[model samples]
Target chain A: MLDNMSLSRHISGQFNAELESIRTHVLAMGGLVEQQLTDALKAMHKQDVDLARRVIKDDHKVNAMEVAIDEACTRIIAKRQPTASDLRLVIAIIKTITDLERIGDVAESIAKVALENFTNKQYNLLVSLEALGQHAARMLHEVLDAFARMDVKAAIRVYQEDDRIDREYEAIIRQLMTYMMEDPRSIPNVLQVMWSARSIERVGDRCQNICEYIIYFVKGKDIRHTSPQEMEIFMDNNR
Target chain B: MLDNMSLSRHISGQFNAELESIRTHVLAMGGLVEQQLTDALKAMHKQDVDLARRVIKDDHKVNAMEVAIDEACTRIIAKRQPTASDLRLVIAIIKTITDLERIGDVAESIAKVALENFTNKQYNLLVSLEALGQHAARMLHEVLDAFARMDVKAAIRVYQEDDRIDREYEAIIRQLMTYMMEDPRSIPNVLQVMWSARSIERVGDRCQNICEYIIYFVKGKDIRHTSPQEMEIFMDNNR
Candidate 1:
């Protein structure tokens, strides 16, 4: 019986090691995806088709990472029968990876848009778009940080920061409308830029989703669809 | 030993039953969200503010259902450590519910835009938009059908139909651009309508996601980001 107990402990340790590996792999994948978005936006702003194509090429790596992460998650779930917080952590990792994979797709979408509109004349839309991209990239980074640290406070901060992105998105839309009204010649490229902004706005929303998962992992609470004020209060009480 | 064996069997049975319940709950939620999208479109085309408000109100139910399904998933994952296909089913349900919930939000967004533009007297943009909505609503319905039936063939139908939505979406954008150019008075309402079209187009894309998930579940293949010809081979081989 003592030998059996030792063997069971050894197996449990193996699972724990695998979980840690999964976490590391996911963060690495997140870093790659975040870089994809940054480079895509920079490509668009600088009108660099080569950089845009590079981002597009990098998407396959993101896709491969997603599949690997997913397989690792499934293996962990099947092999380890983890319970409670351990189970939630694995499941959250699975869900968060899905969001990250989709964010990578958004980056690819932005890159594709940039590629299509590369021949068009430059415009001021990139300024607001760069701001939005920067804000969203920061949110993703913070969420990943929160996950790494299990810092609910940092996750909450990411949640609160989403409003900045929303406001910036709205401002860009308004600015695009005015530009389109003044010069119809800018309509095609302006519309592409608007769609790209919308895509990045969605990227920000997905970041908030990652934050939500972190909160779930930390507190076992379902803060989704709850108001920001209520979330703040809940976070305070839980913390 | 007999009791232990029976207990293990009972737990396994409970796991299977809970998974069935999760699937049923997701289907019900999908039905409600699909209706919300359809009615939101109908409300916009017919200028039915009451119907639009109803869609908005129904959003609360969709949100509640999402929470309920998520809770169910978490409980199952926590209590019963399912294996293999069962694990995939649970994970797919979780991811699919996220997509379904987001679809509900898109429906709500469409309803909000519809309600806000209700005061405008202009109605000319409704022609192509109505067509776009019909196509999108049909695509969503078919995609869900593909999901429920696990019909890889039917899922491929979604990708084939997407080009139709794209064509209609582009046509509507072009028509709206001409309308805005010809008369500034129609700009605001037409823009709102354009926004609605864009939302519907995105809803179609989400339907594509559902189909892709179905393929993954049924055929054990990741069809995402793959070429159409490759997907056809996947469906052909898997079917």
Candidate 2:
């Protein structure tokens, strides 16, 4: 019953055809999330409330994509009963889509932060935040690329990139803290930036999550909660 | 070939048996997560570093439970190839366990906040946090009960409770903001408390997620992103 040729054919045939289509859909959605992140950052840097609102409004489409993709995966599992690697692929897509949707959420949060620029102050912090935003966006794009290719090493690269993001985020937070301590009047504005920075850190975490799911799907290992250095070790040993 | 009686027996017998076992497992995991939250709050309120450390240590077990349940779901999908409501139950369990694990993570975050009790200041905020923690604890317990019974109305009740938690969280944030503005020296401690409160707010979010999944499982409707008032209207019409 476990015919190798038949199994191979099954993988490349109908089940994978559907899987491939879902994969394409997920990648397309990932492209949308990246654009949302970029646009949200642009909105903040330029104080474009209209673009911020657009980012918030576009999140519904991202949310809808998740539901649709999840339904397709469920249908595939019920119908095709994909096993082992194929099953992992489907599950990874499901998990990654959740992260992608959350990325969209983080973008919306940043957009709201953009709307809070009542004083139009702190160009330095805004530039720093833009740098953080660009880094997060690029990391997200890479991780999505890794997922689309099932690239384990690329996933690890994204995993390693998170530490840099974390450091940059904390530095921004420290600067914001100094701002708040010096001028109590800027507390509300600084608080919004701090919250937005927190959201970007969450984006890094989500990107890390997507990377972890990729390795899990490809290698069947759970590397979550591992330190970046330990992740390197684990990947080395597992690979 | 499509024998109704056999299919009926199949639904109520072996498949249901496996389903019951997984449900029990999930509930056991929920109980552990609830204990983790309570212990973390105790650690913070009473300044029990040892207990906080224990909470952090216990998260590994929660993570293990998530992996085990996910594997079981994958096995059931691969072997039983469950359809319709049965399939939705497994998928929802998979989704719910991720939220449960994240709740565990939040508890760990709170425990770490307790460990930050170096100068031992902010007793009032700590007490307020305990009240918020207790409310979140009760909400978590009720949501799990709703989940176990697949009670959509009970789940909706829990969903509605998160708004109260959010309001409480915002009020606390405002109080903390004033503290930071008045006593600049307390910024570090205040920042830790703010982070901890954010984690607790996220716990509320994760609980709301679990409730939504329960309703989705029982009623097969997506009420996420809908306003609470709109949710009530949708539930009444859909129910």
Best by TM-score: 2
Q: Could you give candidate 1's per-residue lDDT for residues A1-239 as a string of tens digits?
A: 22223223434567878987898899999999989988988887777899999999999999889889888888888888887777778878988988999899998988887777433344567666888888888888888887777777788888878888999899888887877777665666777787888889988889888888887876778789886688768878754
Q: Identify the runs in model 1 with alpha carbons over 4 angstroms from their true place.
A: A1-12, A116-122, B1-13, B118-121
Q: Residue pairs in steric clash, candidate 1?
A: none
DockQ of each candidate, alpha-carbon based: 0.48, 0.56
Q: Write the per-residue lDDT of candidate 1 for residues B18-77, one digit (tens) a residue.
A: 776787798899899889999988887777889989999889899899988988987887
lDDT (0-100) at residue A103 of candidate 2?
Answer: 94
Which ten residues in a row are the worst by lDDT in model 2 chain A?
A: A1-10
Listed per prediction, chain B TM-scores read: 0.88, 0.91
For residues A1-239, what per-residue lDDT tens digits would candidate 2 score against the true structure?
22223224535666678887898899999999999999999999988989999998898888889888888888888788788778888888889999999999999888887777456466456767988999999999999888777777788888879999999999999988988888887776788788888899889999999988988877777777666687668878644
| Candidate 1 CAPRI level | acceptable
- Please give the CA lDDT of all the candidate structures: 0.79, 0.84
lDDT of 2 by residue, B21-104 (tens): 787899999999999999999999989989999999889999989888888888887778788777878888999999999999
